[model samples]
Each structure stands twice: as structure tokens, then as C-alpha cells.
Target: MTDTATTAASAVADATNLVPSTKAVRLPGAGKLLLAQIRYQVRLLISSGRAIAVGAGLPVILLVASKGKDTRPDVAGYAVFGLTITAWSTYGVRLVAAREDGVLKRWRATPLPRWCYFLGRILATALVAVLAGAVTVAAALVFYGSHFGDGPDTQLTVTAALAIVAVLLVGAFAWAATATALTSAIPTVEAAFPTLIFIYFPVIIVSGVLFTNLSEPHWLSTLATYLPAQPLIDAVTHAVRHTSGAPFLPVRDVIVLACWAAGGLLGAIVLFRWEPHRSTQRRAARIQQ
Candidate 1:
């Protein structure tokens, strides 16, 4: 080789040799990494104007407006709705978009475990759900004079408060798990957004929370009974009622939610990918059309 080429090759080799093959940098604690991920997810969730309106603002309005005999049930329903907005729209959109855009792919290259990332998303959304529920309850106390029907008894308040928290946390996790699975399996954001809309409206409006009675045609009631939304609504509704000293029936609701949570999470774990899927290619083809 010429002297110039030999000199250039030597310089490159020296640079390559200067790079450390291994460093003793300590990996972060699991807790810290998880917290960082949660912080990112929560920040992303609140950034969206639509998410703020649907997930936070609407519930506040509903709580204030829903003054009457059925106030407790209405409050529970809207609380679930708010939680749904966080999980289904807020988190789902971010996850799918990030995956398609290679952001998740880059995350996979880091030292952060994928499960921690998933856990952070779940934790953040669930936290939001609990906060929304708490806010709704506080609003009721302030605006409606705490007419939750259990009176000022300390025991009743304690029991109801604990139950509400438990119920909201469970429902939030379940909803977020299901959302994760849906977004993971769906190919494109363009397709998933519309699918979410079609599913969200009918299920929320006609099924359980909004219209607790589906017995108009009998089959409607049976259909509602079998659907995922009803049971979740029932669980939330019963929690509110039970806490307020009303009778509770949560066996079916809990069962349904558990089933959805298990199935959805399993699907998400199996289907999730770090890179964009064929959905992108399909979008490209559509654009060319």
C-alpha cells in the first residue's frame, strides 16, 4: 500500500482500539428506570388537548351536572369513561405511533427492559384512573354535599373509600391492558384510530355504563351481559353503591374484567414488536393507489 493509505489505515485502527470494549458503568436500579418510564408516559398523556378534555374535563363536568337520585351510578360511569380515554386513546395512540415511527425500536436498543416500559405505561394510566376517580369523589363531596348515601359514619366512609380505590385500580389496569393488546396487534395508526372509535361509541353508549338497562329487546340485555364493557361498568357501579352502603354484586364484574385482563395482556405480550409491522407497507400501497 502507499504511505498515505497505510497512514490512514493505522489512524482508523488506533481510533477503533481506543474505544472501550466494556465499561463498568452500573446499571440503574429497576425502580429508577421504571419511574423514568412512568414519567415519560404521564407527560405524553397530558400533552394531548383531546386527552385532557375527554379524560379530565368531561368527567368534572359530568360530576357537577349529574345531580339527582342516580348521581352515584352516573359518577361511576363517567369515571370509567375518563379512565378509558386515558388508556384507550392516550396510551394506545402513543404506543402505536412510537412503534411505527421507530421510537420503540430505539428503546429496545437501550438497557431498559421492555417489561419495565410496559409496566410504566400501565402504572401511569392506572394512576391517572385513580386520580380521576378521586377527583370525582371529591367533587361530589364539595358540590353535592357528600350525599353518597352512607351518611357521615366513619366506618362507611372508610369501607367505601377503600373499595372505590380497589375497584378503580383494577378497572384501570384491565382497560389499559386491553388497549395495549389492541394497539400491538393492529397494524397501522390510521386503521387503529377508526377501529377504536367504532368500538368505543356503541359499547359505551348502548351497552352498560350509559344505558344500564338493555332489556328493550331482551337480547340486547344478554348481549350487554356478555360484552366486556358491561361487567367493568357493573364493577365500578357496584363499588360506588357498596361503598355508599348499598348492596354489592361484583362476582360477575370482577370475573369478566379478570378474563379480559388476562387475555388482553397475553395477546399484547405475544404480539408486541419493536419495529414497524406490515401495516406501514399497506399504508404505502394505499398512498400509491
Candidate 2:
């Protein structure tokens, strides 16, 4: 080749070198992406009428409904945070919807990390749950004149409240993780809704907080001991009663709930997939064609 040709070729190569990378150069961290997701989720939570009722309204109503009697804060906790679990379970459904709608698929094509996506959901849900819990607590204190423990035991009551809040917060993250795993396996949002109902309502009904005494020795009551919700409630209740000088250890209950949380998070990380299920349908249809 001539010297001119060589020079032209070299210029072309250098220009190509400067043509910018197609491999998606990632900046520092996924923190901004995760924060954006959390903000969007918070807006979604606040805008939904159902979410308002479930995340905030229900807690206050349940607290006021107790009507100045022998009020169990655990019952209030259940009403407030139980629906929080249900709401976060809907996070799983959102995953299904997003996948089916191609939102997750598009996101997967980006440089934003996977953990940030799910972490945003968990953090957002936890925030809403904590808000609901705060409302319930305020209603208990102001509306019903409820007390965690009698006078001269203020410090113990505060300790119990903190412990219960901590349990609920951890449980929220667990519910978010577990529900993500469950809904990810499901192909459609419609199916996911029913699955959530089947998973949530049965556990709520059988927790024995609604009907039977947890102290009862029946097999169903015994079975409740194995579930996460019941154990959390038990732990909080023990904390409350312990404030009144009762000797109680919530180790068994806290351990059970913590195990559930950890197992759920690990399961979600392993089992949840962002890929759309429609790929199989498309391939099958093409084969038929």
C-alpha cells in the first residue's frame, strides 16, 4: 500500500478508537439508581388508594377500635404490620407485572445492579411499614390511652417499644424478600395475587392472635409457633409483659423470626429471575409457525 493509504488507514483506526465505548461505561455506584427507585416506589405507595388504607389507615383504625379495654399492643402490631407484609408481598407481584410488561427486562439491559433494584423495594416497603407502625403507636397512646406498662416503668416500656419496632422492621425486609421469590416463580400477575392471598391470609388467621389463645395447647395453636408472624407477636408481647416485672425471654421467638428473614433473603437472591417467561411462548410459537 502507498504511504498515503497507510496514513489514511491509520487515521481511520484512530478515529474508531475515539468512537466511544458501546459496552456501557458504568459510573461510581448504583446508589443513585436505587434512590430513584425508592422515590418512585414511595410515590406509588402514597398515590394508591388501597395502599393508603393498607399501609396507614388500617393501623389507626384498628388502634381506635380496641376501645379502651384490655388492649394487646401485639394485636395492634399485627393489624398494622401484618398488612405491611401484605403490601410488601405485592412487591413480588410488582416484579411479576414489571417482568410481564418488560420493565425488568429493560432494566436488566442496563448497568444498574440487580441488588439495588430489590434493595430499593425492600427499603421502600420498610419505610411505609414503619410509618404504619408509628401511626398505630400514636393512636394507642393518644386515642385509647393505652399503656405498655403501668407507672414507674417508663424506661421498660420504651425498651419494649424499640424491640418491637426492630422486630417489625426486620420482618418487613423478610416478607419483601420471600414474596419476591414466590412471585418470581409465578408467570402472571393474576396468579401472583391469589398466591399471595393463599400465603398471607391463612397465616394471619391461624396466628391465634385473632381467635385462640397462644397459650392454648391445641395442635393448630402449636403449629402457629412455627410461623414467623406468631413468633414476632410472641416476642413483642413478652417484651410488653416483661415491662411489668414478668420474667420472660424472647430468644426463641426472635431467633425464629430472624431465621425466617435470613432464609427469605437468601432464597430470593438464589431463586428470583428477571427474565420474562414469554420467551418460551415466543419460541414455541415460532416452532409451530
lDDT of each: 0.70, 0.67
Native-to-model Cα distance after best TM-score fit, residue 62 in candidate 2, in Å? 3.4
* Deviating ranges (above 4 Å) for candidate 1: 1-26, 47-50, 66-73, 149-156, 243-249, 278-289
Evaluated with lDDT, which candidate comes out highest? 1
Lowest-sum lDDT 10-residue window in model 2 = 147-156
- Supply the TM-score for candidate 2: 0.77
Write model 1 residue lDDT over 135-191, tens digit each, in one string.
666666666564453333312255666766776777677777888887877678787
Candidate 2 colliding pairs: none
- The alpha-carbon lDDT assigned to residue 19 of candidate 1 equals 68
Q: Backbone collision count in every prediction?
A: 0, 0
